[model samples]
Target chain A: MSRIPNAFAKGTAFIGFVTGGDPSPAQSEAYILSMIKAGADLIEIGIPFSDPIAEGPVIQEANLRALAAGTTVDTLFALVRSLRRTTDVPLVFLSYLNPVLHYGYERFFATCQEAGIDGIIIPDLPFDEKDELQAIAAAHDVDLISLIAPTSANRIANIARDATGFIYLVSSLGVTGVRSEITTDLESIVRVIRSATDVPVAVGFGIHSPEQAHAVAKLADGVIVGSAIVKQIAADPAGASNKLYEYVREMKAALGA
Target chain B: MMADKKRGRFGDFGGQYIPETLMNELLDLEVSYNHYRQDAAFNAELKELLDNYAGRPSLLYYAARMTADLGGAKVYLKREDLNHTGSHKINNVLGQTLLAKKRGKTRVIAETGAGQHGVAAATAAALLGMECEVFMGKEDTERQVLNVYRMELLGARVNAVTSGTQTLKDAVNEAMREWVSRVDDTHYVLGSVMGPHPFPTMVRDFQAVISAEAREQLLEREGTLPAAVIACVGGGSNAIGMFYNFIGDKNVRLVGCEAAGRGINTSQHAATIAKGELGVFHGMKSYFCQDEYGQIAPVYSLSAGLDYPGIGPEHAYLHQTGRAEYYPVTDDEAVAGFEYLAQTEGIIAAIESAHAIAYAQKLVPTLSAKQCVVICLSGRGDKDVAAIARYRGRNVHE
Candidate 1:
């Protein structure tokens, strides 16, 4: 496996997610730059899928908005290629399997390599089906990040054993949405994941506020905030940059302390 | 056509392409299905319910009048329309609901298109004393108001989905989203032979009783197999059921009629097999109406039940392997077929099932007199009368 530089090595990495082309590609690019400027150690750009079953209403709407804006895989690759000229914040793609399949797996990974994308996280592809895409992803030096869920009690170690770049620790049992409480016994899950691999585990799903991020950061190597950032972009597309910057700054601060 | 348990595949189609949050639940469900599928007690209970409750062993009525009118092939109709709840949907819901109870799940949720599956699920939940909820498109709830009311009367809550095209596909997306959160206590009774893994395989097995019964009845009456077996395809549940038992009978040509809303060439159609690309949606890798961007397009059909963007993975497999032939039937032809069956055979069929009859009308005319065609009359037309009346510009209420 060609090892791409790991962003989780940065202390308490604060990752921000935004659906590409939410509002417009230009505006979304600006939003991402601002989040990075505000202290997001890593950036996750969601390639919009028609049906995002793992997401709640907030991210679902964002996907609808992006697709309506005529966003496509080629468009996102072009946008990321432009972003590569400017930033070095470890870039990852979040999308469903169909787009990747339709785009052609080998071409998709080769494009990601050219676009300077370090990883891909397909929510629909579980650990069992990772082998379908893992070989190609590794060949392109693009990590096919694994997600460890609370319900993945026995399968955590198996998933973590082959996990590259980082392991995404799902802090809750449901789809991606803001929640007041994450009831999963994350500590025990994390212990199992840690025992299997030296890869950093970045907790995600349902983590919204600074307090939630801070609470999760204490147990994991990093914290990922998705719907919360996508919500800001959707709530005020015109002024998303400033709002997202402030929100990411606060969440980053929580991760630090 | 049994799918492999580990791969969950019908050839290159049908796999568990879902989020990790729901992986354990699907795996757990697979284990439960494997264990109970062979259990004699489980089979006995399900068989008893199917026989007494859903009215299993639906008649294989030889349509003498239709046969005489066609002047070619002998015609027989598998009367799934005569089943309780007026459709074959009860067969699957009964099987899944019974399994849910076995797993100690106290609640069940499902997605519906034309409201037939919703009504069936509501009936099963009420019978079993389990909480039930169904997600239906807002457009469909209004169109199939009678079925919605029937579901409510049967003690199931119905959620009107307004997302995407506000049709069957969107309802499935909403139900799947809801399922992830309540995976522990609730079982998702997927309506069609679609979705992730066990759902496609399991639902087909339950509905396969249709063909299993038909095969024996046909042999008893005709002393041989029919020349062809036909059913409508949306997510392809009824079609798969009708074809499963007859797959090995190579001479029995398995035909699936897809809804060509306006025409296959036009933007308005749900003919996935005729005009679709291989893509994953709602968990299964199948043929979908997708654009160059890989986004599933909003599909249209006069029949709400056939207004789905994708077909079941097994249907895709069948079509690909040349084991099944799919034809497109326009709305105009389907309406004519609906009225023709009513006049010729004195049977009014669901708009979804009429698509198959429409195609059979064309095919039977070309076949030899000794040949026979068996049509899966998937549901009755009571739920579709109002909609059909509106489409034909006549108000039955008037």
Candidate 2:
């Protein structure tokens, strides 16, 4: 009965992320469509926040650019509404909690429902504080996604049991950025999560390069690539759509391989 | 006397709304704080530092000349300005730095808006033999250069943050970002009673000594409770500290003066409780200066110390429950208060504290001669002299 489609139903899913208005809304919309065409199973749109504490410099700069270009939550919703008309890609909003709180939780979730947002990932909203927005997200059939970090330790099982949609397993111990190596004992964390829940888990954060994506996909249901995709837009916004599409295709192919 | 249901949360505010990566660190911090705060040895060492080093039991001076000049109520000034670093900031930095040492962290990091907290943190770190680094907004470092030099002189490495608005909020953002990676060896000495839990409560407990001393000093001198207790609110550290002991006293009015910048009607103000909407930012669910898009608005004030986008969560709770009254003090009113008190009492108060003095000037006219008022002079104005001179269309060499 839910409009939200499963992103991992076919194969090792490819989840691609882009800030809603990194260069401009139209360009971002074009980029998203291109990524979808290039085999992105799920699309995560970042709603730029003034203070994104969980993000590293790359994403932080992207957020600043998006905000500079006049990106608002309403405009992001409008973008989502437009995307829903042509594609059935599972779309999620990667945002901090303040914007949603300011938008009014009830209205925010209701708008997400109308605009066809499949899930919401607020990195700052830990499991203990999930109740603040969980009921509203559920009432609108929006998945309030949970994150299980390498540092979760005893809290991993607790977070896993209540997770909806897919769990976002953070690959490293720090903020979202590309890393040469992920030293966290992710296999142990994934084991703890698997023992507790039946929901699918997707590994994210510090994942860049198709080889890295291939390696992460081997461990989980899907691989989430964010900063890598966003960094392309940052490098050349004029040629971002084509470049990002190529990058997404490569990552998606690697996931399947 | 309503108790917080969770470890955090003052009413519907305050929580660990941080990234999952910081969860274990915060949990570890909470455990260490809970354990050490109750330990007698920890309390005794902290008490010794407060008394012998930072100059605790700060003077409760009777402002007789100002009281006579105002011609309404007897007035007293809780001289937190007389502390070693010339502000109530030493009260909190000393406590946090000591705790950091106990946690075996060798380095301490902090963010500063006005640079007073930075100076205090640097002072504490130097005394405790810990490495100190302070992140200050580039704009703030420019405005408060003397304090920047003072911090460097005290052996602190100051990083000027050039990100978003280049102000206090940005400084805090950079500090928190740096903390996420280096939390292993560094303890973030958050300057205010804001941020996530334990911080709001921890800072308040450390600052409560102000009101505790003021209450005793006032009772001894005046033989009765003052009609009101007043302090300026940025993130509401000194205000919360000055107000903590008096919360149960139903008749003692607890007043907080917020920076109105140019005016409350203008978009440039930092009067969060006066003009902001309830939302979550900087880890706490409190009133913040934000737009319809939920982007934090650029907040301004002549006093760098008072130029913050949000108040502490406890201030939000107190404002919501009507436990205290908050008023907006315009830039002009605060500057006038600064000059007025300087001329009348020969005391140059920090412009942040001048907001409280300005509020007292208004309230004093309405009270009887027998009534008394007490204001927390949260810091000295030496660091602000150049800024004040610039405001008056004058230039200073030193």
Candidate 3:
């Protein structure tokens, strides 16, 4: 079945996200392996899109860099295949719907299965629009991860109930970026999600520091970091492995795992 | 209009493909819009504003000189250029701003391309006493500098977006980001019929006044329906408005002219229908000019208004069902139409609208003189004088 469940079977999961083929496909594979080696429970590889509407400037720049380096869907799938050869860490893809749609739903998920991808996180495909790919994703044993945002007040229970893989709880309002402080009441949101389903809830968006990761891990089953880690890669694409390993290790440790 | 096969869907297109952070707000906006659209007082207030402030019942003037010059179909120009904000944008802006006010939203934000929609949104916000901010592409700000000053003078903060392509699509991306940050007290006054549902539907209903008036006016003047109705399609608000009332008329052809910057064969055109694939983007499933990987391609057009990568989802649905026909008009042809209309009718239409005029030059000649075609002059050309001069090798600067 899906490797996603085993990720949260332990204590709080530590999810590290990096844009696939950022800088280059080889460099991205190195960085992902680094995170996995540093005790990342799962890895989220962003299939770089031309216009990543859900991202802030940091990830947007990374996507552009990845695309500039000739990153494509096929290349990213190859990267996943390479990653699967080295490690069995549960892997997921964070992408917008367009690239996946362009790849053809059947072919994309089938390839994902072959490449050992566990789940997917599509920022644009909310619960209402999930019907387009939900069944196809399930047939491939791919967990179509659901997201619960700060504004998902009444929708929390409904979305959480039907959610698979895990529930991605957005730590704050707005696009994916680094925030100085996340003031949203996540504990309440997680409580509602917990009452609705047994699926793990991983808080993401704006979680940069270990303290923030530790704080989030208290209320949720996992802590997900993206733009902050992407910033590390953007700073030094070649030398980001050591930095990512340390950061992921620190964040994982902060999760009290 | 054909009924949506599903809620907020037009055939297989137009769904709320957005983040969960914006879902509740969109649902609330839909509820508020649904309520206000039926409320008598809301309609009367919007009507009063459209009539008195924005200038409704825009003239359907017979272009006799051009009609005789062309020696084909009779021509009528829907004078949306004569509106208060000098385009059809004010029609939707006024309606949305009023609805935002009713929803207790004190601030309004919008994305602009040619700055017509930005200026219109600013004017509506000023009239309704709401805070206004407009995001425009950095390139557009340079191209349409005069409209930039116009919006600033009208008390709106204009942000020159420096993101991807630095054009209309980037402006929209920036605006959506701003809205996601603050959806509580603020409302995103989407400028076109492109964005998520309620926007395409609401903007069309607001702009339907164009055809509602033109249909009756045409009947009163010509004693029968025109053979075709034409308008430029950027995000296709004006075209949809012009075609909405006449959609049931099987004989009346609904024509849309898309901007082909250099040519459709080149990579520089913004002809989404002519050279695009189906993809989900900017909060809707629509036809977008994209690469094989579904990455939105950077589109080009002389008219900043039409320099968008995608069309409104409804237009996609319309194109799919063979209900409307869209043709790509090159910038050179549009410029020719721009000059021709100025000289013949003493009316300088917006370059975006000139695309429709350029297409009419080809289409009208194919029809008999007994037939007629009405073109929606979506905006004034005053803002384009400097650009047109520059395009013609003159060193004119605004």
Candidate 4:
């Protein structure tokens, strides 16, 4: 073990998203910067593709807008190059493995590391099929974060024991979307995951507001607010710098940061 | 390639269009298949099961009275209908079941059309104490009664798929979606030589034993291979098997007949070979009858077993290659053939097999008088009587 200390230090961290080249390449960098100022400890920049199987309608629609705006590998790398100027918030590229594989895994890890990316989250690449890819990620010092679900127990342990950074615990069985309330069953899922490894367990998939984040943060080491943050960005797609900062500040306060 | 050999084609069909996730897996499978194809270890395993369990090497009977009446050429029936489960479906099922057990899959998932494949898979799952879940079209669950009972008796939970057209297509969609989620502990025990990549190759290899055994039996009895071989095509397993060994022999003509519920001119038919277009459904790219938008059109067939929207990708590739000639047998002709075999030969043939019998009738007349033709009477008709009787406008009560 590299003795990587406890992740993000309890309630002080929040992860946000910026679709690569959203609206245009310039606007995407602006949105990511605004999110960082609003107290986000990490950033997940999505590389839009034609097919995204694990995504729900919201992200899928957002991706379509980004694709229409002429997002490509060159544009994405340029945007990431721009984001590294101000924030040292551990940035990560989140996507299905296909895009990463297409970008070439070793090259992707190297480029992202060069641009100061922390890790990656690929929803579909299970741990069982990740040895060679994991080795490549390790050689580049990029942690490929593993996702766990409610039904995943024994397998979650396998994932948790092997995964670095933090364990992404999806709060529900369904795809990512806005939900009304967190269920009690999530406690058991968190319990199972916490038992597996000492890595911080971050709960996501439905935390829309600071209240929701605070409730989940009581059990999980971190809370992920995706759809809610994305929804704020959608309201002012061209520019929402103030709204972005305001939303993150509320989430940080709710988490008692 | 020898006589009757498709030279890697099925009659004139079978090709591979797949993703990178499966390429290595398929190559591994092909390596195993090639290494074991002629190996005594593989044959001994297949042979032992066929003899001790499935009661295979089933009889080759001469339907003398029917042959004399139809005239033109002598006819022989390879009795696959006499296999353990009253059908040839068990042969492939047992083989794959053993393969799954060996592969260490804790559970098995399958998609079924007429439910014969479901019953066969469930039987294997029950016998081996492995978990099994079968996806059946909601429409088929209502249509195939005895098969539903048969599968339940074997302890398989049936998922009635409601997506798409709510038939075999939907069942296949649901099963594949489930397989995508549970590929770790589960083996998708494909029913036929259809679906995406490895399945087409794997199912064909397992079922090829049918024609392999039939070839030896034919040689021992007639001193040579039969002049022609015929079988029905659904996902085309029976058709593929009865024709596989003959691929090496050039003189023997192998024919696979598909169902045309009405005339090929009518939309109410499963003549995928004749009328369907190019599209991917249930995995591999095959001939499918579709509308302008590319969604699969509703397929129709008098036989539940034959009512599929797309031909197996291999069969489509074969049709394109011209290694096997594709013919469509109409519902009227198939029904008449079913009764003709039942009343004449005293063996009830499945509605699916009726298509082959219908083709054999037409083929016998076209061939020279002394030519010998073998029709693979693929399944027994006990399960199909109600559907056939209803099609004939008769009440089961009477």
Candidate 5:
């Protein structure tokens, strides 16, 4: 059989987080393309929740802006529904656990499958208490991504064991926010995660600049950029489309992908 | 003697009413419960934990002087009050806490009304080294400050909900909503035989050991089944457990007394069985104190444990099905019963359980002179001793 598409199978991946309806749907398409052009292998689109326990202020503001723009579960569905029309870049939707639970697990997965969402990352929900959801994810074939926190090497080993699609490693101890640098133990996290499985290990939460992404690129299978992109879009929600795209592309170039 | 077999029903009381998100999870729990509930090893493990960890096989105390003072019927107390944490709540908590760990969950969350369940849940969580959060109404936090402090000392976070009515119903809604979101890594330890489907059935099953052991102890002591068994009803766990083993006896009468703070006719009451109408809240369909429009209305009882507006759905079904007769005992009667018990039996009971004592107090005179009665002393009077002392204008410190 022919191999999977080169963009997806590419060794070093670029993951982009664009708040759906940020700037506008038209701008969202533009930002997505710029990231695609700059070697984004997977696109992590966020559908925000009101009580986001795991997110800090940047993404929270982006979610508020998106909510203010009438973006919703339906709107996110519609975005995925529309994106399926043009792109095949693997789509990983970052959402708080409540919206997904409120939407009902099976229906959400069915909707994801219908809208072509490739994976899910719910930061607050850990792995062991996932028996019910695990069945739903398996049934719909929508990957339920896992996060290994900074503290638990043994739990990281276990979470890495239960993970499917790709392992989403949270870069710090706290909620998602901008940080000064990736920690000194960053390489060991990658090594520990890699030891648990051969699945691609993507590091997310704080990488904002090309230099930071490049620094992490030396150690991770992929780098995820969220708060900065959301911050840029929030700064100019109306004129944010092209600027957001350029920012994503510049970060990608600095990572040398 | 499992009242809720097949559909997890206690008579026609329990069944599932969950969103589709939980269908698969509930199904798995049902399968495991059905399988493990009968497995010898499962039963043995649960029994060992109940004995060693929960300090079970509580005692059957002969209320000799109280029996002589009543001067008619013989009364034996099934002392659930003497258990660890000073109540029967530990029995259910230890059971569910262990089960949560077995299911690979790292944390537990629970909602509390009187705070008995919250403290019990916190105790189990601390013992098991699991993360625990107890959701109490902001109003309840103020009312039940001692229990709140007790829960905090157990290393559990006590979340105060200010939304909705700021009571048991509101706390439950918040807890269920939290469980819906965090089901991936947490087990919601429901405090009573309330909520939808499995929980009413699940919690009842855990607490049933109370009545099961009581039945055997009663058989050995009284040489026959008690003429009646009574327990107070809040969300109905203690009552259900006390009556569960007696359900099949056919000759044994089962009674549940709800708190009527003043009278059922007055607004100041938690008499769900007497004054409630058909309504739904916190997952289960049940009898709730509601307006003509069926909107949930505020309910009051001096006892924090009986302040909830709705009775457990299984209790409702048992009432409707005529398996158990329900009554509402007023505050004056309950306080009188509490004082009578402490003076005569030398045992204090939680104010909530005093409702049952008051019911039994009324029943003893009316029963045939030789008849036997076992009133479930569901919890100790220690928690309510301060309030009782205050009610009588006596210095509790003295």
Candidate 6:
């Protein structure tokens, strides 16, 4: 029943991410619709947290902007409900565990199902600690995405085998940001993940530029971009929708989708 | 012994709630720590550093003047202020840096609030010949300027973090980010019993030497255990160390004093246990001062060391089980205690430790003279003289 599988049913999937309620809830909804219109296969909406340790300066600043705009969990759920009326794109949430825990697991996931959210990616909740919310997420028909980094050498196969929706492969060793050059051997890491499961592998973190997306699409099933889109929104909040549409379109075309 | 029922848990608290990039490194650190904790040679080397370099077996001095002034319980002060780095932070820093050396780590990084832990880490790194870097809040660097110079003189790079609520918590966030960037030849020498897994346990074990020595010292001097033991709690390293050996003693009370900047009722306070809720941040599930939306609140305190938003997980477990008692001590009362100790015993204790002294001032008068109490004097107050003078409206330059 999850729409995550359909995202990768085509050739390579183009996943675009933006922090929900960034600038404003209305603007965020408009931006997400823009990406969807520009051929984004799946969309990841970040629920702004107070301290996002996993994020870099770009997304951290965006979280502050969203929070400063008086965005809350209830407002974001309303935003999603509005989006579902027009679009059937596979939507996911990127959040830290605290906000989800504060919202109560049962209520948060049930609301996710009602709002038409297909999956979630929690950067702070590693595979060892996923047992706290794994069952509850599965009971609600939501896929709990798992991440594998370059440091996750032996843990790659074990985590990939049990991952649902898709596997988020970190392109480098640091926090989320744009990098001039990613020198990590992602092809070898993707090979280990491919050997362990049939799930789609999507690379994110430090990914930007069409050339980088095109190169990554060759080895993985999807190419995910976050900070690059967030930077566009930060530069000009009111005009971000058009910029986001063009950026997502360029990245998706580079994926050869 | 309060062994964790789960691998990294203390009751329903304490888990490795971190990114995947750091999980393998934490697991490896746990394995290396477990191996070295029991190895006799490693223990002997650490013992040498603690005894010769850091000055262990700190005295349990009978505070005759303070006892007569209070006119109630007999008082003893555990003199951790006399240690080489002027605080109890040296105890854990020596152990961690030595362990990092044994594990073949070439560099060490840490986060500090009052700059006590930063100085301690730099000293240990210098002694062990490892590269050292410390992250401190930009606000803290202004308040504790001299300590910043101390860390620099000891050969460590001090990074002024300017993130959210630029304080101890932000420093921790920046340190974790830096560690994620380079975990191969680096070791994050966590300063307190607050971080993920091995840190809370390992730091506590290293600091448990406080109560281990004090218990025997009390027995040798008083011929019996004290009625209560008291220490201030920030990230709660010293308090946990002071309370660890006494946890099995049902009759001995374990007390912790928290920093209430203005008062617990006001928004300007760092009293986590008094006003915080349960949430996960900074790699642990514990009581944190946060908003209804789970955003970490900016906490305030006169003492930089205790200006943290969350408490250690073990402290959270201890509070849940009602094994220990915690109280909020306002900055005014702590300043009174600071002056009281300096005038009575001629010992100026750290403001963070003065919180415990403030609570003792209230509790001692209610107890009978036959009973006794011991307070952990966790650090020296030399670094606080300028700040304290400024707070009293005297604006003395450092």
lDDT of each: 0.90, 0.90, 0.93, 0.74, 0.76, 0.93
Residue A99, model 6: lDDT of 91
lDDT of 6 by residue, B1-398 (tens): 11234987889888889999999999999999999999999999999999999888899999999999998999999999999999999999999999999999999999999999999999999999999999999999998899999999999999999988889999999999999999999999999999898799999999999999999999999899989999999999999999999999999999999999999999999999999999888888899999998888999999999999999999999999999999999999999999999999999999999999999998898888988899999999999888888889996988
What is candidate 1's lDDT per residue for A1-257, written digit by digit as tens?
A: 32334466667888889999897889889998999899888899999998888888899999999988989998899889988888888999998998999999999999999888999999988877776788998899999989988888778888999898888898887789899999888999988888999889999988888898888988999988899888888778888899888888888888888
DockQ per model, Cα: 0.63, 0.60, 0.65, 0.05, 0.03, 0.64
Ten residues in sequence with the least summed lDDT for candidate 3 chain B = B1-10
lDDT of 5 at B237: 89
lDDT of 6 at A240: 90
| Order of candidate numbers by DockQ, starting with the best | 3, 6, 1, 2, 4, 5
The residue-by-residue lDDT of candidate 1 on B219-277, one tens digit each, is 99889899999999999999999999999999999999999999999999999999999
Q: How far off is each candidate at the interface, as Cα RMSD in Å?
A: 2.9, 3.2, 3.1, 11.0, 11.6, 3.1
In angstroms, give how far residue B352 of model 2 lies from its true place: 0.7
Instruction: Please provide, for model 3 over A1-257, each residue's C-alpha lDDT reduced to its tens digit, 9 standing for 90 to 100.
Output: 89998889888999988898889999999998999999999999999998888889999999999999999999999998888888988999999999999989999999999989999999999888898999999999999999999999999999999999999999888989999999999989988999999999999999999999888888888989999999999888778999999998888888884
Of models 4 and 5, which has the larger DockQ?
Answer: 4
Residue A26 in candidate 1 has what lDDT? Answer: 91
Candidate 6 residue runs with Cα over 4 Å from true position:
B1-5
DockQ of 1: 0.63
- The Cα error of candidate 3 at residue B313, in Å, is 1.2
Worst 10 residues of 6 chain B by lDDT: B1-10
Residue lDDT tens for model 4, A23-82: 677877877788778777777788775444445557756776776786766577777778
Candidate 2, residue A77: how far the Cα is off, in Å: 1.4
DockQ top scorer:
3
List runs of model 4 lying over 4 Å from the truth.
Answer: A1-257, B1-43
Ten contiguous residues minimizing lDDT sum, candidate 4 chain A = A1-10
User: RMSD of each candidate?
Assistant: 1.9, 1.9, 1.6, 10.2, 9.8, 1.7
